[model samples]
Target chain A: MIICKVVGHVWATKKEEHLNGQKLMVVRETENGGGTYVAADLVGAGIGELVLVISGSTARMALGGNNTPSDMAIVGIIDNLEMETT
Target chain B: MIICKVVGHVWATKKEEHLNGQKLMVVRETENGGGTYVAADLVGAGIGELVLVISGSTARMALGGNNTPSDMAIVGIIDNLEMETT
Candidate 1:
């Protein structure tokens, strides 16, 4: 589970069968409070929200498959994310 | 399965009844190869397309769900990815 910020969204007219009617979103990967990559959205996230993204076979399971051809999925919306405050 | 590269997209209209109509994107995290995190297009990726992402609970069964809040999903679509040139 990686911590990220909602940054954008994606649109596709043609896609895989299992992907039909599914939402996608863009989230910037964060680490120690900073940015990393820019990815297409798989969740309905809005800018500024902290979110949790899952990847790999785990991502496949999130969408309910081992053959859906997906590798990432947003599975949670963090109401308030906090690290250990020293 | 976290090797990635796509770069953009996102849109929304009220959400979270299991995130009806999902799609999102953002930026980034990476190590040795460069670039780290910018996610959101649960696959159906374009741009400089080079992607592979998955996350926790196998991203909740890849969408079958352990209570469907979604952690991330984009199971697979890497026509070609290679490392090791020594």
Candidate 2:
């Protein structure tokens, strides 16, 4: 699932201890109308809205993990985005 | 896993109950040698670094559950990304 915005948030106080309670944001990838995909963000979205990111290993269960060390998250938060042009 | 590049960061408080302490970053996607596929960041990656992301229900696993409500996570940090042209 992809169609994003939320363009910013990330700060780490010496990370990797199972990511120590997580929330990260910063997405791009907007293609409901066109193209472009910027990555990074563990949900907690804002900016331009229209989000729904999830990548490999199911993004390590949305951060809870394949032992932390995240891949991607931001499960949902899209009011409306439909594309099925045949 | 996709080839990626992070150009920045994000920060927030009073987000979703499940999205308490995480980090974010954004940018347009990059191919190993060609294409473009910018998406969000979930891993603790740095500028110009390659990372791996997981999506979907399994993304739920990377986090903790389908309950916490996330969809992606950084599954691995890529050291190499190779694509073959047919």
Candidate 3:
């Protein structure tokens, strides 16, 4: 899983049939200036919210085992990050 | 799919059971200087070779779909990129 912020939305009239009704959002990784990528919203994540994104087969499994054709998906809205202060 | 260059190799004596016998390599995306990620090599790609890396369920499918835990896999070695000049 990767930590990212929901930065924007994607509106597509023509896309893969499996992508119908899926909410796509633009997410940028919070650390390391990671590249931005579109991810399906599975957890009602809002713009500017810190989210957890899962990719690959784990992404598919998150949506109940359907062939959604989505490589990435926002699975959780993170409340906070717990860090161990040494 | 993403285009990347094999920059290095990863050797592990102990790893996930599913990752056993897998060839893991460090790949850096050629375009946009994308972040580096470890990918399982499915096409016998060597260091310094430009290759195609597939992610998500596609990676698992390329390996015959036996539930490999890998999220990224080098599927092809690119000889060249064809671009059309306007």
Question: Judged by DockQ, which candidate is best?
Answer: 2
lDDT of 3 at A85: 48
The DockQ-derived docking category for candidate 3 is: incorrect
Isolated chain B TM-score per model: 0.33, 0.64, 0.88
> What TM-scores do the predictions have?
0.46, 0.44, 0.53
Candidate number achieving the greatest TM-score relative to the actual structure: 3
- Candidate 2, residue A40: the lDDT equals 46
For candidate 1, the C-alpha RMSD (Å) to the true structure equals 14.2
| lDDT (tens digit, per residue) of candidate 3 on B62-82 | 554657888787765665443
Which scores higher on TM-score, 1 or 2? 1
Q: How high is the DockQ of candidate 1?
A: 0.08
DockQ of each: 0.08, 0.09, 0.08
Pairwise DockQ winner, candidates 1 and 2 = 2
* Residue pairs with backbone overlap in model 3: A56-B56
Better of 2 and 3 by lDDT: 3
How much does each candidate deviate at the interface, measured as C-alpha RMSD after superposition? 8.9, 8.8, 9.7
The alpha-carbon RMSD values of the candidates against the true structure, listed in the order shown, are 14.2, 13.2, 9.4
